[model samples]
Target: MSIKLPDSVPLHRGLIREFHDIRVSDVSSSFVSCQKEIYDTLMFFLESGIDYEDLCPLVKSNCDTYIQLLEQEEESQGFQTKFKTIKENYKEMTESCEVFDLDTMDRYAERDITAPQLSKLLKEANDGYIPKIKISITMVDRILRAFPYIWKDPKCILPDSLLGDGFNNDANEDEIEMAGGSIELTCPITTLIYEEPMISKKCQHTFDKSGLTEYLKNSDTNRYMEKDCAKDGCSKKISMDDFSPDTIMSLRCKIYQIKRNENNNNMKLEALDVL
Candidate 1:
């Protein structure tokens, strides 16, 4: 017997459509996951490529920006907080002390007063018989000291990692052998080949011994006075005794000079052969 099919029966098409939708959703999810994976991988490679030298300036810039912002914010806050107090105090002091004008009073108040004098004036003011001028001077001194410029240490050095590996890894064994197996050496002071290398005990900056000695002799007014280190950004006071001969560095310089002379001779011979 033949069975009649239902008129609404598109069950095959519906099943196909449902399957297609599920597949599309799965594919989209997988594509998004793959894109994220690719981004993460790229970021990892980028981050890995940044060596200490590359990162140092960026870190310094960020620190400087942070400090500037903090200082500005503090200054704005301090001015706003102190302005009213100062104005009120000035008015009261001027009313009590008719002898001094605002400018004169301000100049006198801001002068460097000893700690003992400040304490005595504050105590006398507290006892209620002292003149208002003394109280105003103490207040001015406190305000000036409170907002004094903070001094940051100027001495900074690059870490060994940032200075790079002393050896030229890119040069093959043959090139290193030709160069007498000595890494490139330069004086920190003159940025030239080191001659009679001497290292500073305080900063460890290498310089030509004679050059450094000459510089010290010229810069120092007296033998007893401490000399500022010749290295850039190093403010450490170095005496004549703070320098020592760097024997290994001196040996490296000698080897480098020998290699350079050999290279020069070879170049001259090659030029004669070409002629």
Candidate 2:
């Protein structure tokens, strides 16, 4: 007699139930507070069988609805004012010919301007030419509070193994020691232990740099879609400028691979001796 496997719909319903149970709070507060929760819930749904491309429209609709609700609120007025101020200030700073010369333009084109360099330029622009200005905590808080509403639609959500808590959470020292102090690091994309790891500047997610580069180069669909991080629910857009060689992770992976090989060899030798 043949046995039938259960359909995924039931499993999906179960996960949805779990999601609602965990995040029962109304979505009336700061978008940041609920952003991670929404992303997590959506990721669960995606894993349960939802298509990534199809989910984009649903996500956009929900986000738009939430944004409309937020816009109708009294608090959003203050947020708008602060956003305008920052926008004006940034515009003024950028428009100054003295501040943005050929060298600055070249660096901007190369995406080589680091945080300190930008800070220094801002300081220079503000010191003599413009009135001394300080960005208040209220403004910063308001921007962060509204960011989730503005940046709601993610291009794609990849597998959980790629960009979720699984990648960020490290094993405890005790666990590491118990596991012979050898970590098994896998690339979320390749599902293999790390080889030539690269960290994303946008999300800090690590992947095999060469593998990612090749994937990006070859994938016309992803390139057209403006490929972002493949981590479970991360929406951070990525490009060649976003990756950096993760030498530390590479070294750790090498050590772990070597240790695992040695252990396997020793196990085989012991079994041979017994035989």
Candidate 3:
């Protein structure tokens, strides 16, 4: 008796064909499994949410592997091609990313709008004058308040940090207050306001205008008045003839007349001593 076998059992020439089909099917299944594993691994590293610097090398390696796998599967039909296409699309999307731009100032330069190229741009901008600047209401109000006290330079723009402090490139807000004697003397850049100028009397010793005037009037000696500015640019000479009686009296009285009237004796004695 020949060996008996079920219909499912391979026999003679058909057996080899059956074995070849089984082998091909198993190889195809294993290739699908390998491709799925590689895809999953690449996706895990890509989506790891790590810093770009740390992930860059891993991403490059994964991409190289993916490209190689795609080349290998060029003859294959269906799923592999679809996955490779998805990855290529993803690479295109990711590699096109960009960073946002920010505005910053270079303090070393005197002007924000600088020489040559920048000057040309500014000229062009001013010619058209679109006024593209954006500012908040609070900033406008603050600048408006400063406008009366602060003098602006023709070519300079003041930063917000410099405002509240005195802004002439010298002295802080507190020093300005001290010099003005607790008042902020706001004035246009070109004008001079009255702070007493130093004067020397005919006696030849120097005193401030107020000190000299008080000495002249209260003292019985009747010394003459003279104005002198020690500075190189100014050579103004003051005399009693050039000034009014009230100006003379104001210069002589250390206290304003209103204050002197209330405490006349002390100021009168001080005024008398210069004689």
Worst 10 residues of 1 by lDDT: 146-155
How does residue 215 of candidate 1 score in lDDT? 71
Q: What is the lDDT for 40 in model 3?
A: 62
Considering TM-score, where higher is better, how would the candidates rank from best to worst? 2, 1, 3
Best by TM-score: 2
Q: Pick the candidate with the highest lDDT.
A: 2
Q: Model 3, which residues run further than 4 Å from truth?
A: 1-26, 75-275
Query: How well is each residue in 1-275 modelled by candidate 2, as lDDT tens digits?
Result: 75332211111233435533432233335544554455455335434444434555765665455445444443444444444444445445434423334545545444454112333433554453322222222322332333233323211222222222323433322222112323346777787777788877667677887668765664655452337677656677877677887544554454344445556777899999999
Off by over 4 Å in 2: 1-184, 218-225
Q: Which stretches of candidate 1 lie over 4 Å from their true place?
A: 1-184, 190-192, 218-224
User: Per-residue lDDT for 76-145 in model 3, tens only?
Assistant: 4333343344444433442342211122122113233222232333355445523222222232233332
User: Candidate 1 residues 1-275, lDDT tens each?
Assistant: 85332222112333434533421112324433443443344234224534433434543544354344434444444443444344345335433432333444443354421112223433444454322211111221221221111101111211222222332334323322122333447765666777788876566566787667677775546444467877666678886787788544554454344445556777899999999
Residue pairs with colliding backbones in model 2 are 163-231
What TM-score quantifies how close candidate 2 is to the native fold? 0.32
Q: What's the TM-score of each model vs. the native? A: 0.32, 0.32, 0.20
